[model samples]
Target: MMNRLKAALAASAVMLAPVFAAPALAETELIFNSYLPPHDELYQIAIRDFAAAIEKESAGGIKVTIPDTSLAPSDRQYEMVRDGIADMAIVSTGGVPQLVTLNKIGDLPFNSPSARAASIALWETYNTYFLPFDEFKGVKVLSTNVLPGRQILSVGKLQAKTVADLKGAKLWSPPGALSEAVKKLGAVPVNSEFTDLQEYVTKGTVDAMVMAPNSAKGARVLEYVTGMTQIPGGLGSLSFAVFISQERWDALSPEEQQAIQRAADGLPARTGAAADEVLAKLAPEMAKVPTENLEGAQLDEFTTLLQARIDEWKERAAKKGLSDPDEVLTFYRDVLAREAKASGS
Candidate 1:
């Protein structure tokens, strides 16, 4: 069934192929490495849907080979591209903080309302302020994308009613800004991947966890996480940097580059769509379990607390020689507002 689905997807891609202004004779092959498993929809769509578009747009001259692996995780994907271990890979900067501080702006709590707004702002930031090429010496970024925001998940009884309620709780979180946020909430932050969530929750090693609405479904952790709070409006919005080895990027013909860029145009939109789809698809089942939607003053307090963290991030950025921090932040805010207004957010 999966193969048939992939085949059908590939056919659709070829049908929507774009015609280039000028045709070239040279052909190129690029390896597209991902940390996601094959069964995951995001990985499949990227490999099958996006790759098909590339092949079609290049008129069959440019081929992208996607290898499925969890061994080379997202944190290592940047290094893989930098050192040429892999030609190209998708990475989340939030996974490694010290090395990529600038990228964390996308992960600031409550700065963005949804993945679409965040993704658009992220592209603008990367292009205008934090140019990926300038920051990472040996690789070129082909695309940037945003994931959905994280939610606070707990077992048996809910404890995240007030900021004070989070005190003394053992909470599991991925490494990066969110971990820091957990610390602020007075929860002990345990560094664990989403895959470990169910085990940790079931065994009482972790009383709560921060996860994307979709990730619980992908990792099958929803079975253990019965309560969820919308405490992280922007914490889930991670900017994914897709890098191609400079050597590989340089080797490609101009035609291939054009084809690749054309293929990458709507990556942010697609990623955001995937996130929304996950929420919409999962909401029904999630409703079967007990869930309370936080809004009004409660939601406002969460956003305010999260915004304080954003201020700290800006100060950190300034210390790192990103002069005009306010300008960069203002630009981000403005972009968010513009996109939100356009989308009726």
Candidate 2:
């Protein structure tokens, strides 16, 4: 009887041992910071999809979450993420030129008829030329993109049908090539960030601005801009990049890294399309905005002025060790041409 009882106890112990020894797998959490307003549905979708892909690729070993609001101001996001205040971020390269001028290839006023084409072309350029650079040493870049090529916009009706009309005009200008373009065109540029422009627009303090139409729409300031000049090759474009802290990215398992990269592959085109969709949706309304159609000599002169900016960028690129900036610029434009045709842009 005692032997039988002991045997039964031993059998129960053996049956429970496996269950007691097994442990639940821990999930690695990544926090994503969204500095821009949540108006960009496509970008938001890409981020969400990227999160899902990461989870799927890692087989649920990793999880990501985006809070309802930003973790920091738009200007400070690069620093925030670099410092590991947040694990991931998508920030405009223009805001952190000191940290990432190479990615500014997207900002070079290198215009495209389609933002999608521009974005993809720039992404490819980044991988080919800028990816190996040490500027992003503390960050792991996921993707780079250009906003919809910026068009010249003004509040109220204007006869800005010619570059001469812009002479002596005070304009809100983003820092960098756009600001330089405005200056070269004889406009007084009030250098400022996007956040500062709304206040000026609301008060009619500035005469005009060069910005992506979708950005104006996203910020709900479209109603304020009543004049426009559409440029297929924008005078300037905003560049942006998405990234994770190098420490955090390195901490991820090798499999997780591969999975995350695979997921990141979709961001550039998605962000570009989001800008286009917003612009397209507001097209009818924008059409109502009085436009200055620069023609003949005016068009040539305006383009000539913008062309100088390209030379400036090439000089800067050479300084950055591109060896031959013209070759790289040509490659970028060629890619844009091919991609534009493929996407029917």
TM-scores, all candidates, are: 0.85, 0.87
Which digits, one per residue and each the tens of the lDDT, describe model 2 over residues 1-345? 999999999999999999999865647899988865555664465566667777778787887878788889988888998888899888877778776766776776646556778888888988887787767768888887787777788875455677888898887778776788888788888876666778888887888778867777755677898788766667788877788999998898888899888888767888778767777888898788887666678788788877787788888777877788888888888988998778776
Colliding residue pairs in candidate 2:
none
lDDT of each: 0.74, 0.78
Among all windows of 10 consecutive residues in model 1, the one with the lowest summed lDDT is 17-26
| Model 1 CA lDDT for position 290 | 57
In model 1, where do residues sit more than 4 Å from their true spots?
A: 1-26, 68-71, 232-236, 295-297, 300-304
Cα-lDDT of candidate 1: 0.74
Cα misplacement distance, residue 82 of candidate 1 (Å): 1.9
Clashing pairs in 1: 110-234, 149-236, 150-236
- Could you give me the TM-score of model 2 versus the true structure? 0.87
Cand. 2 Cα-lDDT = 0.78
